[model samples]
Target: MAQQALPVRTARLGRALGPEPTSVSGVVLLLPGGEESSVRRPSPMMATASVRALGRRLARTGRADGLVAHVVHYRYRGWNGGEAHLAQDASWAADEAVRRYGDVTVCLLGYDMGARAALRSAGHEAVNSVVALAPWLPEQDVATPAEPVRQLAGRRVLIVHGTNDERNDPELSFRLAARAKKANRDVCRFEVHSDGHALYQHRHEVHALTEDFVLGALCGRGFSRPVEDALQAPPPLGLRMPLATGFGRSLRR
Candidate 1:
């Protein structure tokens, strides 16, 4: 039988994450990479694609007892505001996720510009974990996030970036992850030998990893799979990575 194309439901994104927690106890918010021109609009197709693949890979985690997995479409950050725009969007998404989902945990999944946006959203209270795919962080390049996220000290962040990212050096992802770790002990980075700036080359591997990690979070260490295996990255340097305090040290904001 032919598989049905996942339906694209246009749902409002602001306020109330809605009420009701699925068995998995979480949801994924897909944000757009920043807008540089008319070209920077949110890619519903790509967002949907990520959600489709991730939602399936995440199936065993939430669906064990028929839990519903919602793939959210975050508000678009139309030109201007740079990192600050991303930072604010992230917070709004978190607030909305909690309101709608109530007590369920929230895991943010963002790529490219969206990835940076997801990272900014990390400091919010309800976000249990963040899946930052090729994210940019707050630093000289971008301003420190709004007061709230800047204060997040214990949130969990996961970063995945390809060795061949076109827009920026892939090393940027590691740097951001390192900054996040320095910011909070729970951050980790996974480097994938993916192609281009897209998620085309390593679908199955990525999907498997997402399934394991997200499940591991909600199940609270009871996942059949070991968390060590899920990371699939270099050994975490334990929590003392030097913060990026130089190179572009700004005098004032």
Candidate 2:
């Protein structure tokens, strides 16, 4: 009897914004969050909406720099434990960017579970930097090993978490950032005080910081003073730097 063939899952890229792929100097891949253990195809969700909004903003802001942005549509709706479906999808997106754009730099901007995927996928050769917003990190326990930071070496990483986050532990992200900083001095983490996992309380500040880090990494622009200080400061201080209000307004001025 002939065995039935299994279906193959594939990740895809959403419509892109900004300059065409061949003309762009850099690309930003937006990875959206999903559940911890669901294989179901994703429907529109708040997490996806968040990253989509961010992608549009990045496309608009980066247009003049010849930067392009795309939202990554994953094969499944979960991290799926060790399978890490989303991370694999992110790496595929990076590879796709390289295939389409030659050797241009790539940045991964992700939220929640997507943030974890971005961090994991940064090891891709085409990826130059990452911006993780309210990342959902694994709990410290024997059952689940700590996420690896060694892969972050030679890449710039920015992790932003809300101090009052209830869904994901900010401490975990700080720990990851501290470890990553040892491997790459460009790693930094920022805390949005009194905000929750969604980081709605400081959305503008978060967006501003992300823009600063991504542009600084891919377009050779200077990072804002706070980000620069956080990246250069010693552990603890750097890992827990507080994000200030009006940060975006100040940057524009």
Highest TM-score against the true fold, candidate: 2
- For 193-233, candidate 2 gives per-residue lDDT tens digits of 99999899889888888888888898888888898899999
Per-prediction TM-score: 0.68, 0.94
**lDDT of all predictions, in order shown?**
0.53, 0.88
Cα displacement (angstroms), candidate 1, residue 175, comes to 1.3
State how far residue 10 of model 1 sits from its true place (Å): 12
Over 4 Å off, model 2: 1-6, 18-22, 44-47
Candidate 1: segments with Cα more than 4 A from true spot? 1-11, 14-24, 32-34, 37-43, 59-61, 65-68, 77-79, 136-152, 221-253
Q: Clash totals for all models, in order?
A: 7, 0
Number of clashes found in candidate 2: 0
